[model samples]
Target: MAAIRLLSFLDAGPLAYFTPLGAMALFGAAHFSGYVKPYAFPLLALFISDLVLSFTVFAEFRTGLLYSGWYWTYLAFALMTVAGKLMLKEVTISRLIAATITATLIHWLVSDIGACAVENKLTFAFYLNRLVTAIPYELNFLGGTAFFSAIMFGIFELAQRKYASLKPAR
Candidate 1:
């Protein structure tokens, strides 16, 4: 997931929003046991990836170890993880799709609100405009989340079928 995010440097366009982060958070929440494995690891990966992007792709925008408003992204990610935990206890195709949609919407709302607050244009009009204009990017985000979630979950399901040890202990 970190590697996939780093690849965003190759394209800063709408496609830049296409990333496995939402799926990573969801996957971690669904599969990994314990508080640290599900939340800390994915958050750490996100921070490390952001650190690299700050120095390389977004150097001009960098203010410190991370860019400004970094907390907003992290908050959204954490919320997505929580969403996965609440929504995906069984992990079916429909649940995956629903969780991905929820994650995408969560990211869009939280990050865009943060952007508005950071820019000090927190008016209703500005917020609405930001939300309206960001639809395409969010759609790409949804697509990426769905795509990666399917791949990750499908592979793990297959592996569990082939290797009994791979299945979680009841």
Candidate 2:
């Protein structure tokens, strides 16, 4: 838990999206292979990290981490879990990339919508403005999603091969 929190803190730092948010959402969906696990687990991660980040690092910026747009982003992440439930199996690199890309795009779009609505600019110009403004964040999320997805799936694949307990029943 501490390791995940540290990683999430690093990820939330201004410079890097090196967090495992997207990856774990996908992983929870794929590994747990159930509805509740997919949403509850990764969302729990977000909850804990957001709480800690709120009181610690991000406190100056905002009193609480649960900002107005947070729900949209959380929903988007939950959708990524659903995408994992539907899209990932056999745990190949290609599948990981595809799923990561799809999920990241979804997260970007949905969360941006919330931002747009909050800013009262759901128009084309607003969308374009955010396109420019949020490009960096989108890129960071994409890289983070892909990087962690690779690690999570790679580790699981290795474990499954080496340990009978990890392998799916035949």
TM-score of every model? 0.94, 0.85
Q: Please list the residue runs of candidate 2 whose C-alpha ends up more than 4 Å from where it truly belongs after superposition.
A: 1-14, 60-65
Q: Which consecutive 10 residues in model 1 have the weakest lDDT in total?
A: 8-17
CA lDDT, every prediction?
0.88, 0.77
Worst window of 10 by summed lDDT in candidate 2: 1-10
**True-vs-predicted CA distance for residue 108, candidate 1, Å:** 0.4
Question: Number of clashing residue pairs in every model?
Answer: 0, 0
| Residues 85-128 of candidate 2: C-alpha lDDT, one tens digit per residue | 88886566788788898888888788888889777888988887
- lDDT for 111 in candidate 1 is 93
Residue 98's C-alpha lDDT in candidate 2?
A: 85
